[model samples]
Target: MTAPAARSLVLDAQALSLLLRNDRQMITRIEAARRTGVPVLVSALTIVEAVYGKTDTARLHWVLSRLQVQEVTPADSITAVRLLHDAGDLHGHKYAIDALVAAMALRSPPPVLVLTSDRDDWRKLCGDRMQVKDV
Candidate 1:
């Protein structure tokens, strides 16, 4: 038979923050994806970045209501650490959250699209494993 359809879209912190801020483009993209029955995913690390401050509790809740939050599992954490190490040693960059986001996106099935504002880092970390949609 045919292979299973690819899964959801992953949102990085910047993209999620844009959605929280009600950016028209991001909202429109999310709405269009929802219309096509594709759910949006946000890594736990991304949530940490987006809701670091005490303000915007209501806004955080609203954003959460619109997307699925994927928790960082032990395996994901290990992979993230490895990614950080590799990038730091090779590219002179140490980005924990971005690595975690990449790990989460890579865990998903093929054809996964990651909505991100920082395209370069994600591109370096993910390579050709997933598609990065710059926002």
Candidate 2:
């Protein structure tokens, strides 16, 4: 049987940080997706989470150059609220970025895969709609 088509790769803050630092495994994953022509996505908020005063501006720009940065619209924020609510005990202050990533993933095509260090949170937020792979 033919292999399933590649799913889009979505990066959360942790994964984005790894990529920004040129982590080998993260680069491998991103390169694989690029070679396969599958889109790699990142929420605009994730950039804010990943970048900081200590962040290397040149490296940050280089890492972001390869991925699609999805804007968080008002609708996306609403969806994040719903995701946080649906997560039962996952509150906004701690899980807002994850919820936003999940919301962005949901809006993308089906069979999305998110790379995150917070696998449990991502799993809870994404359910079965998207795949969560630990970074």
Best lDDT among the predictions, by candidate number? 2
List pairs with backbone clashes in candidate 2. none
Best by TM-score: 2
Residue 79 in candidate 1, Cα distance off native in Å: 1.4
Model 2 ranges with Cα > 4 A deviation: 1-5
Model 1, global lDDT = 0.79
List clash counts for every candidate, in order: 0, 0
Question: Over the full model, what C-alpha lDDT does candidate 2 score relative to the true structure?
Answer: 0.85
C-alpha RMSD of each candidate structure in angstroms = 3.8, 2.1
Error of 1 at 18 (Å): 0.7
So what's the TM-score on candidate 2?
0.91
Clash count (model 2, backbone only): 0
Error of 2 at 41 (Å): 0.5
Q: Give the alpha carbon lDDT tens digit for every residue of 1-135 in model 2.
A: 743554788998989998888899999999999998899999999999988798899988888888899999889889999988888867856798778778889899867888888888887876767777788
